[model samples]
Structures are given as structure tokens and as C-alpha cells.
Target: MPHYFDTAHRQEIETLRQRWTARTEWPTWLLLIGVYAGWFGLVLASDRLGLWWSTVLLIPLVVLWLSVQHELLHGHPTRWLRLNKMLGYAPFAVWYPYTLYRDSHLQHHRDEDLTIPGRDPESRYLTAERWRGSSLWVRGLHWLNKTVIGRFLLGAPLALAALANEERLKMTAGDRHAWRMWLTHGALTLLMLTFIARYSVLPVWHYLLLISVPALSIAMIRSYYEHRPRAAPEQRSVLNEAAWPWRWLFLNLNFHLVHHDLPGLAWYDLPHAYQARREQWLARSGGFLVQGYGQLWRRNGIKAIDSPRHPFH
Candidate 1:
């Protein structure tokens, strides 16, 4: 693989290193407060509004909350790790524990392992042996999952089931971290559900079906084509100069290569860093660029990007 940056660019990058302060980040705190207000406001108002209307308002907020949690996992908007974890402590997404997410995401920063199936926790590809051994129905589902349409529709539920099964195996094998994470997640989930049942107009089941499921679906649109298997690790991740709405919603995460390169960089500063060396970064990624998610939908809306099989396996 070719070099990603020259001497001049390296100096440019050096100047952008984050400056840590003793104070909290007010912008991030305000965002966190505003997001929670909107989410709960919608929940409380669900009784007066239409069911679909509530879902429409709540889904994006839920997705944004998860995005905020992703930033928190990176120890952003704050210098203290405990405080960051506290802010993201709630299990409103109702899927994974924050601790588990933090651990897995940090591990995913190993750029060399990006999109290597089992090696990368975030990878969506399947092993060749697993694909060949799958039943025809299972194979068909995998094919459908590769597309944007099927991904959001079926991806969340299937992924949740797979995660649960994986957690079960880990617990069975006496993984204490897995056990603690799941226990914490379960307790938080129960508390959240109880609150919803007692105070919110939306029932717990309805909240899960409406807010949680669709939030996962919205997230799938971003992750669907974020990475692909390649010999050169730099080329694995994509750079999507998507619209402002997406950039805001995903917190500038569309610049996957930038985040992978600078895992500790604050989310708000990604665009500046990317723009500073737009040409070089594009070259670094071997031109793995997408105009937007719309382009991805148009190209892979009907056909799959690659077969489910991980050729190496």
C-alpha cells in the first residue's frame, strides 16, 4: 500500500492535536440535555398524539442518542471517562451494554483488522465456510441483508439474536466481563421499561417496536457500506461526503477512515481534519468515496455488494 500522508501533511496533522482542558464541554452537554428532553417529551406526549407521529419524532432522537453514546465511548465532550460512561449509562437502546460497546468499539480501532469478519466486531461479512454450510433459506436472508432495503428491515432483529447467542456462549464459558455487562444491561433495561410503563404514554412493547427498532434501522443505513474487505487496510473504510443532515445525525461518522485514523479526535473536529487533506485522504483511501447514502441505495438497492461469504474463510 502507498503512504497515506507526506511530511508536510504530517506537520499539518500535528497542529490539529486535541487540547485537553479542565472544564466540561458545554456544547456536548447541551446536546445531551436537548436530546433527552425531546425523547422524553415525545414519550410523555404520546398519549395526545398519533402513534405514528410519536414514532416519527422519537426514532431520530433515539438514533442521535446512540450516536452521542458512540462519542461518549470515545471519551469525547469530557475529559473524565467515568462521567462519559455515566452520561451514556442508560440502556434506552435496549440492545447492548455501554461497557461492551466501549470495549468492542475500542477494539475496532485496530485498523489492521477492519472488516476481517471474526476479527472486527463491526464487520458484516460472513466466512466462506459459514456461507456454504448455511441452509438455502439462511443464505437467502444473508443476501437480502447486503442490500439497503433488507438491511434496515431485517438487520436489527437478526443482529440482536446473534448477539444474544454470542453472549450466552460467553457466559457459559465463564466470561466475567460478559456476565457483568449483560447483568448491568438487563438491570438498566428493566428500570427503563418500568419507567416507561409507569409514566410514559407509550407502552414498553410499543416503545421497543417504534423507537428502538427504527433507530436501529436508521443506523443500518449508515453502517451498510461503511467498510469492505481489502488487502490494504487504509482502503477498507469509506469516506462519504454526505449531506449535512446525515453528517449531523451520525455525528460526522461518515468519515470512517478519518475516525479510524484518529480514534481519539473529537467528533466535531472531523470535518476540519478531513478537509485539511481532502485530496491526500482520498488518495489514502484509494478513492473509496461515496457521494451519499442515496448513491449506495441506488447501486445496491436491488443487488448485493458482495456475497455473504468471506473468501478467505
Candidate 2:
């Protein structure tokens, strides 16, 4: 990370950093606090409003909260690591811990290994040997997972299970750090659930099924095609330019290739930075671009966009 930027880009980034301040991040902190309070308030009133209606309304807020969690993990909105973790403590998303997420995501930013199947935790592609050894049913599921619809419906739950299983194995092998992370995450999750049970009109199971699942599914839309297998590693990340509502919900992550190129850049500044260097970014990514999520769904919602197995594998 010390050499994250070359000479020219380094100067531009240094100038940008000068303008960033703790005060600049107040809006983000305010939004996080407001959304969490609002979401919990809605749940508390679910009996009167109806559980289905409440869950439906909560989906977007949960997505926004998790997006902000991503920003916090990257050391935004505040310089203090302790304050950042405190901001990220709520387990509204439920399954993942901020500690584990921060570690894994930082590992994911190792540009040289960006989308390599076995190397990247966030990669959707299966390595060749694994694909070759899989039963037809397993292969079919992987193929379906490549499509927008399948990803929307199945990705989140499957990803949760996979991640949990990975952590289970690590803990079993005596990874004390992994053990501590999961233990702390479990305690916080139980604490959140106990509060929900105490006050929410909807049953805890109903809340988990109705709200958590759908929120995670919505996030899958952002992750579904963020990267692709490519001959050139740098070109693997995609630039998907979405308009207003979706862009705002994803916190301007549609300019994903730009984010990958400069992982330390603040979320709000992404759009401006991307616009200023639009042509350069497009060129750097070898033209891996899209208009929006709509384009992806239209093109690959049913059919697989790429094979489940990595092409090189």
C-alpha cells in the first residue's frame, strides 16, 4: 500500500486528502444514526403497520447502513480507528463482523490478485479443479449464480453459509484471532436480537426472514458483476455508472473500477474523481464498462454472463 499510487497520481491524491476533514464526514455519521434509529422504530411499530410492510420498508435502510459500514471500515468519517469500529458495531446486517470484513476486504485490495478464483474471497468464479470435480447439481447452481436473477435470490444466503463454514474451519484449526472475531460477533448479534425481541412486534424469526434476507439480496445487486475474469488483472474490475437513486443507495459504488484502483479514496468524492478522469479510467480498465445495473440484468439476468468456472482454470 505504500506504493499504492505512482508519482503523478500521488500528487493528485495528496491534494484531495488536504480537503478531507472530520467535519466533512458528519453527514455520513448523521445518516447512519438516523437510519438505524428509523429502522428500529419501524420494527417496533410493525404490529400496527403490518410485518410485511415494515420489512419491505426496512430493506433500503439496511442496504444503506451496510454501505456506510463499508465506508467506516475504510477509515472514513473519522480518523480514530476506535470511533470507526464503534460506528460499525451494530449487526443489523447480522452475519458478518466488521473486524473480519475489514481484514478480508483489505486483503481483497491486493490489486495483483484482484479476481483470481482461489485467491479472492469475494470472487464468484470457481477454480478449474473444483469445477471439474463438482457434481452436475453443484455445477448447475454455480452457473445459475452467474445470472442476475439467481444472484439476487440465492447469492446472499449461499455467501453467508460459505463464509460461516470457512470461519468454522479456521476456528477448528485453532485460529485464535478468527475465534475471537466470531465470538465477539456472536455476542453483539445476540444483543441486537434480544433488543429486537424485547420490543419489535414482529417475531425475531419474521424479522430475520423478512428484513435481513431481502436486504442482503439487494446488496447482491451491487456485487453481482463488480468484477469479471480477464486476461489482464487490472482490467477485471468493472465501471457501472448508475443514475440517482441506485447510485446513492450504493453510495456511488457504480464507479467500482475507480474504487478498486484507489481503495483509499472517500466514497462521496468518487463520482467527481471518476468524472474528471473518465476517459483515463475507461482506458485503464480496458473498456470494462456498463451503463448501469439495468444493462447487466437486461443482458445476463437469465443467461450466464460468464461460465461458472474460471476460463483459465
Candidate 3:
């Protein structure tokens, strides 16, 4: 793959990395502490807050936790992958195992394969063959998945079902690693649900349906059109100039091209890095940019942004 930064830019980024190393990532550490503290604090206070209020408050924390997990998997706040895994392994989001996500996401960083179905594990597109084979209703769901409202309504369930089916196939094929991860995820998820059942006013079912699921739905917003298939690898990922609230919720991943260019760059530094070479970055992306999520909703709310079938396939 071609390097995004030239020699000078790379050296400048190295200087920033050195500075970060010198001070340590205190901000990320604070984020780790604050997100966990807020989530637990809200859970504990759910009875006083009432179900609706608590669910509303808790969803953002859960979404932030997902962002934190993304940071952890990328070696944020610390260099130790094991320690990061230890911090992130809790089934707080209540669906994916940390290791499962880590492995798939790292594969997704292979820019050459971005948005290629079967090659990119995180791809939203379907293979042409699969698209052709699907029933009309199944095809309708894929079309819906391309729309903003459809993504919020069906994204989490569709993604969860696909992941679950993949893991089931792996387990059936005697994949012990898959088995272990799922078992561990099951135990951790059960523990979390048990705690909510015992201590929180929100019912466990309600927590799953209202809080965790919706959090996943919201997180999916960042990725709804984060990548597209382009002939050039660098042109594939998007540069979404999302609003501050969206940026904070996704932890600067709104700068998707920047993150793709510098997978090891800390979340806090992404915006500055992108701003430093804004034009060059934009050029590299072949001008694949959006003003904000609001633009996406206004233009593609009910309309499919692009065909669900992979263009290359």
C-alpha cells in the first residue's frame, strides 16, 4: 500500500508520537476512567432516574465505550495489547467479543480490501452472487440498510445476526478459538445482565432492547458510509466532517480517512493531523468527503446512498 504521508509529514507525525510517548496519553486514560465511571454510575442510579431517563443517559456511555474499545484495540492509552485487552474485554456493549472485534477490525485496516465483500470482514456491501441469490424481502432489507433511517432501525440487528451466523458456522467447523471467544463473551454478558437485573430499575430485556441495541445503532452511524470501493486504496475511505457531537461520540473517527491513514494515531490527534494536511488528504481520498451526518440524512434518509452489491464483484 502507498504511504499516505510523505517523508516530511511522516517525520512530523513521528515527532508528535514522540511527544505523546513522553507525556503518556493522559486524555485517553481519563476517557477510560470517565466512561466506565459514568456507565456504572448511571446503572446504579437507574432506579432514581427512571427507565426512560436512565436508558437515554446510558446509551451514549455505551456508545462511547465502543469507541474506547476501538481505541484500545489500536494500542491507545498504552502500548501493551494484553493490558488493553484486559481493560476492553468486558461485554459492556453486549454483543461482540473484544477479541473477535479486534481481529476483524485489524483485518479491516488492510486498505486494499476496504469495502470488498468477503475480503473486508467489516464490509457493508454484499457480493454480487449473494445479491443475486437473495429473496426479494432480503433484497429489500439490504436496500433499507443503505438508507440513514433504515440503518438506525435495522443496522444493529442485521449486523448481529450476520456475526452470530458467522460464529456459528465457525463453531460448527470445530473452530475452538471461536468457541472459546463466544463462551467467554457469553459469560461476561451474562454477568453484566445479572448485575443489571439485581441492582438496576431497568429490566434486563429492556436494557438489551433499549440501551445496548440502540447504542450499537448509533455507533453504526459512523460507519454507515465510511468507506466506498474505489480503484485506489487511498480513495476508498471517506472524510466525513461530522459535527462536534458526532465526532465526540465516535471519538474522532469521523475523520475516517485520517484514521485509515494512521491506524496507530491516537483518537485525540486525528483532527489536528487531518487539518495539518487537509487538502492533500482530501486529494488522496479523490474528494470523497461529506459535510456532516445531517447532510447524509437529508440526501439519503430514505434513498439508498449506493447499491448494496459490491461494484467490483
Candidate 4:
């Protein structure tokens, strides 16, 4: 990471961004619309298709949809700003607002923006003070989130509530964009709930639990190895740990180095482009971490408190 902050390396990053981000406007728009519609349709169809296929198949589809949204948010698969946000912010995850994500993400790109617990919305890592002050039960719950059981069963709602609290803050403060985002998301949420309430055989809460838990599980995987401040500039992102099924599910975003290198590279192109620049990136990161989430956990895991200076603390 310290090695990566050097001037000679930054030119490489700037070059990659300039060359890859330029694209045909129309195709980008078409791809954006198509992806959003396809995923949203899959959500509705999951109900009709019954629990078996929905969980086994559609859940991954939802993850891919989320991955596509990630790309769009970075200005990909389209040139039009509003259209891209519409696609990414559709609330398919049913909890997070896209605008909020966009805001926090830009902050994340700041040079000194390592993990800051209270200030950084997307930060799962804790500040030093938070780590010290947390009760035994709360610490246990946070640990639970990293493991498979906690991630799938308990982590989803916990994460959602945190996200919704942000929405509530934005709403109370009258942030117009946040207001619009929630309005759109709220209407969709209501429609989804109402349909389940009136006609579905399963309890409405059950349907929500079934779909949302698995969907958020994918989010858990996407973020699993993505951040670490100790490593510094180059090794900032945690490399992907999941293989095969989970890898494709998150659209190869697991390749953390390639992502940081060419932030504008499309999903399909990331792996290839990364492979080309692998050596340079690896050297740059000071080989901070090359393993996946499992390896990370095996090492007693990492936390936001790992940093010398955590804003939350």
C-alpha cells in the first residue's frame, strides 16, 4: 500500500480510466435498461415459480443484478446519468437507496478515506473506540455477520436496519434526492408486500425473509474481502475469496486489484484486463493479502479498528 501511493504508479491508473470509459451512448443505455428489467422481472417471477427455484436459481440472478448496478454506478453500461441511477437504485435489495450509496462511495474514493466507522456509511469495520466499547453480545453479533450462518440468517436484517436508518435520517432532513429515492423505493416495497399479503400462500413476512435474506447474502459475499486500511493504497481492497459459484455470482468483482486499477472497466472485461496487469498490481500492493475471505477469517479476521486512526473512535 505504501508502495502504491507513489507518483509513477498513479499515471497508470489515470491512463486506464481514460481509455476504457469511453463508449457508445446508445449501447450503454440499452444494456442498462435491459439489465434492470431482467432482474426486476426475475424478482416478480420468483414468487410465481415457487420457493425451490427462487432460492436456488433466482437468488444468484439478483446478485448479478446488483453487480451490474455496481458497474453502472461507476458510469458503465451507459452514458446517461439519470438512467444509470434508475437502474442501480431500483431497490431490488429492498433496503439501500442508490443515491446514498453513490454519495458514500465517492467519499470512499478519497485519498485518506480508510475505514471510519460512524462517518462512512458503507464501512463494516469498526473504530478503535467502538471496538473497545462494544458489549460482549454486540461483539458476538458482529462476528456472527462475517461467518456463513450469521451472514445468511442474522446479517441481512441487521444490515438492512442500518441502511434504513440512513434513509430515515435523509428523509427527516428533507434531502430531495433521498426523498425521491425513498418514495420510489417505498412504493415498490409496498407493492411487493401488498402482493404477497393478498395472494401468496406463505406469510408476508416469510416471503420477505426468504427472498431478502438470500439476496443480502450475496451482498455479504461481494463485500467480504473488499476493505483493509493496514495495507494502504495498493492493497486497500481485499481480493475475492469465493470460487466458482460465488465468483460468477458477483461478476468477478472479487478481483480487487483489477477493480482499483481500472475502476471504469466493465465487469466482463475486468478479469482479462486484470490478468494483463496482475504483476504490476501485485507488486504495488506490497503483497498485503492474496487470499480470500476464508483465509482472512482464519487469520482471526480484520476490522476497521485495525487502522491506527479510525474516525469513529
Candidate 5:
């Protein structure tokens, strides 16, 4: 629970928090309204837009909805957890449940466990032993998952499969919590899909395949290199100076290290905090910085960024 920021930097963050107390979090509020309005508006207008065009437009809004969900889980735009959950609980993205994501992401914030297989729920790496023990086909899939195009195409399905397998095991072991969560998620997802089927021009399968899956893929871009195996925990996260488009879509999470350091800071405040002490943050992270996502794509287009095996393991 300790912050990575030094005393003075902590004081500066505290000052920002004080400023937040004096006024409303209008940006986060607007983001909540805007993402919902945009998504619903587009869905309602899909008949005129055609399937492909509507799918293309819907992808960004869905991605933004995921981002807004992230913000809500982080206690944004509201102080009450129940209110926040109510705002984000609709299964618009049509995959993971809000409660599941909330729990997993909070666990992922345990920085010291980051990038470690079995510990960090969001880790992309496997333990060295696990990698060594895998079948060739399994290893090949991991390799494909390392590339940009492959991650875009394979990331969502792979992640979903893994989550399903894990939850299956948990349910088999009589984990009632997991069962309850999935049942609730299933009911809500069915309701949302039903609404889309009745109201939208896009068919249910088309929306799932084109809009929902691709939205998850586009969202995965922010996380593609968000963390890496490193001896120092603070150095594991990357500071991606991504372009404005990505920043807006990911809710400024490209400043991943900053988010890890000050997890309580609002998404809108992240850029200012990082820019304020950019040098110190870079030093603290041991220079784990990417110029931008475009650079990431060009550099790791086909090649793996690094071994998928966790070096520390």
C-alpha cells in the first residue's frame, strides 16, 4: 500500500487531492455521460450507418465504455462504491463482468506481484517453469500472442478462455462466489444482448463478433506492454507517451507507472502528475519508457518484445 512517490512528491499529490475536494470531478462526470450517450446513440443509429460503419464507430465507444468502467471501479466521479457500480454495471462490453474486472484489477495493483505468473491476474507472462513445461503448440500460441497483430487478433479470445478455465476450476471447487458472479454476469449479458437484438440494426452475433471482440482488442493495445518482468517492482510498468487518441481512449492509462504509483489519482489528473515530476518518475521506473504506441507497433510488429517467460521466476 506504500506509494512510490517520495515525501515531497507525495505532498504535491496531496495538494492535487485538496484541489479535487474544492470542486467537482466534472471531467469524469462528463466522460461517464459522454461514453454512455455516444454508445447508445450509435447503436440506435446503426440502421442508417450500415453494419460495417456502425461496427467501426461502435468499437471506439465500447472501448471508451471499458475505460469509463475502469474509472468507475477506481472510485471516480463518485464517492459511493454502490453508486459507482450502478453506473458501470451494465454489461455493454458483453464479456467480463464489472465485479470480476474490479476484483482482478485491484489485485493487479499489488505492484510487487506484477508480471509474476499466478500472482498478477493481468500478467501476460508465464513462469519460466510453466513455459518450459508447455507443449510446442501452446508455446507457439504464446509466441503469437507476443506480436502486435497476433495480440489484436488473439488477445481477447485467449484472455476469455483463460478466465473461463480459471472460473470453471473455481466453480468445480465449490467456490460459490465465482458461481454467483458468473450467473449474475450471464443474466445481465443476456439482457443487454436481447436489447441490442430488438433495438439495434446489428444482429447479436454481428455485434459480438465485430463490435465487442474488436473493442476488447483495441483496448488491449494500452495493456500490450503496460508491464514487463523486472527485478525492481516499480520498474515493471511502462510509461507510454502515446498519442492523444490512445490517451483519450484509454483514459490516460498509457501513463501506467503514474497510475501504479498513485492509484487514487483520477485519470484526468495522471498526465499533469507525471509531467510535473517526469524526471523523477523516469528515474524511479529505471527508464521503462516507450516513445509512443506507434513506436511500439513499428518495433514489435512481428517480433516479440521480449521472452514471454518471466525472468524473475
Candidate 6:
């Protein structure tokens, strides 16, 4: 790996960094078109060729849409928040509320904020206490959350339950936008369901699996080898160079350390920037997953789960 995550400011990168830039909405617009095109095309193709055949194309394309949405919401495809949200708000995901995602992901960027369990909505890591307190069923669920199959099968329901619990807590605290986000997302979710009910010949549940499940599965890959929470915060990061497929497919997200180093860095620049400081990132993460993502699977086992911390706060 040529790139690394650098904390000290660099003169070279400073010149390229944008404090603010004109928003570009085209990439998201193109992606939205692409997603629907994939859905309708797969629907037609499935009728002619059957789902197994369509899965070859369907799975990858759906993955692409989800990744693009991740970037768009992160201020990659645009500078303006509204424009950014407009492009990636595919109610089709049927899992994440885009507003909630934007809020949680932004929180994820705070330096003190990485993988704080309950505090960080996106963390999959478990705190030592949480790990110890688990019952047999929960332990099994945690194991499943770490794998592809578990993510596809149980990810959405588990995620929805978590998000709902969080939202109720927020509502009690009088979070101003709670109702609005719900109503807005509620509309989008309805549209997603309607699209399925009218067009997809498969059960509506099947459409959820085809799109929402895979979206979560891909998310698991991004976080899977990204962190391990050693006693030292600096050593907590991990890398996955064998993740070339997902990195490209996910707009360079597999370069997890770089994102952590300078999160404000836009998606387009993460690759070259990561390469530029690869050695430092490796040192920072205690030699990163430089060994490869295979280590994650071989040692961790397929069904693995961990939260960043317990008691979230």
C-alpha cells in the first residue's frame, strides 16, 4: 500500500482541500437513474431468465447504488447539504432513514467519537462489558451480525429495532426534527414499498432482501476489518487491502484509516491520499490489516459482532 492516514497537516494536500466547493448533483442524479433502471431491468430479466440468473447482475448493481448513496450523503458528490441529500435519499433502501444516517455519520467524524457503541449509531463493535453481559441468544446474534449471511438475513430488522429505540429516546428528549425526519422518511419508505408492490413479481419481502439486505451486508464489509479497539486509541485502526473490490465499488471506503485520519477529506481524494501516507497508517493501526481481509474471516469467523463500546454514552 502506498497510502497512509496522516494526522499532521500536509502542504501538498492543503492546496487541494476544499473548505467549500460548488455542489455537483450529477453523480447522485445519475446514480438514482441507475438504481431504478437496475430494479426495473432486473424485474423484467427475472421474468425471462429467473432470479438466480438476475442475481449475477442484480446483486452488484444494488451494491453500487448503496455505495453511491453513502458518498452522496457524506458531502462527496456535493457541498450543499440539501443537494447532497436529494441525490442519495433512495427510500428503496427501506432500512436507513437518510436524515438519521446523515446525523449519525457526521457524529462519526468527531475525533472523540469513533465507535462509542450506543453513542455512535453506526458502530458494530461491542464493549467488554456488553460482550460479557450477553445471553446465549444475544451472543449468537452478535456472531451473526459480523457475517455476510447474518447481515443479509437479520440486519434490517435488528437495525430498525435499534434505530426505533434510539428515536424514541430522542423524542422523549424533545429533539426538534424527530417528527419531521420520521414523516419525511415515512413517505419515502411508503414509496419504496409501493414500488415493490406494483412492479416486483417477487414477494415484497423478497425485494427487501434483494436491496436492503445486501446494503447492510456491504456495510458490514466496510466496518469488519476497520477497527479492533486495542487499549491504545491510535492502535485501534485496521486495514483491508484485499478489499480492492469493495474499495472501488464503495468509492474508496476500504481505505478506512484515511477516512479516520482526516474525515473531512472528500471521497474522491481518499485513494491517492491514503496511498501517500500508507506506512504511517500502518504504524498507527499497529501494522493495519496489512495482512489482508482474509485474516478477518479466518480468525474472526464468519458470524462475528462487536460494538465500539457498551452503555453507548
Alpha-carbon local distance difference test for all models: 0.83, 0.83, 0.91, 0.62, 0.88, 0.65
TM value for model 2:
0.93
User: Which candidate ranks first by lDDT, i.e. highest?
Assistant: 3
Which prediction has more favorable lDDT, 3 or 4? 3
Q: Per-prediction TM-score, please?
A: 0.92, 0.93, 0.97, 0.76, 0.96, 0.78
Give Cα distance to truth, residue 72, candidate 1, Å.
0.7
Comparing 1 and 4 by lDDT, which wins?
1
Q: Which candidate model has the greater lDDT, 3 or 6? A: 3
lDDT digits (tens) for residues 158-256 of candidate 2: 898899789889999999999888888889889888887887776788767878888989999998988888878778888988878988888888898
| Candidate 2, lDDT over the whole model | 0.83
Ranking by lDDT: 3, 5, 1, 2, 6, 4
Residue pairs in clash, model 2: none
Per-residue C-alpha lDDT of model 5 across residues 1-313, encoded as one tens digit per residue: 2454579887878778778542488888888888888878888888888888988888998999999999889988888999999999988898888999999999999988999999899999998789989999999888888988778888899998998898889999999999898899899889878888888898999988888999999988789999988899999999999899999999999999999988888988899899999998899899999999999899888988888788877
| Candidate 5 whole-model C-alpha lDDT, 0 to 1 | 0.88
Model 6 agreement with the true structure over 1-313: per-residue lDDT tens digits: 1144234537546744643331444545566677778777786667676656665566667677667767766676657789768767766566667777777877776545566675555667677777788787887776786665565456666777777898999888988799888878889878767765676555567667765676666655556556555555556565667566666666677777777766656665776676776776677778755455565666655545454234343
Candidate 4 regions with alpha-carbon error over 4 angstroms: 1-48, 146-148, 173-177, 192-204, 241-244, 291-313
Model 5, runs deviating above 4 Å: 1-7, 20-23
User: Which ranges in model 3 have alpha carbons more than 4 Å from their true place?
Assistant: 1-4, 20-23
- Residue 286, model 4: lDDT of 69
Candidate 4, residue 66: lDDT: 70
TM-score: model 1 vs. ground truth: 0.92
Best TM-score among the predictions, by candidate number: 3
What TM-score number comes out for model 5?
A: 0.96
Q: Sort by TM-score, best first: what order?
A: 3, 5, 2, 1, 6, 4
**Root-mean-square deviation of each candidate, in angstroms?**
2.5, 2.1, 1.4, 4.7, 1.6, 4.6
Of 5 and 6, the candidate ranking higher by TM-score: 5
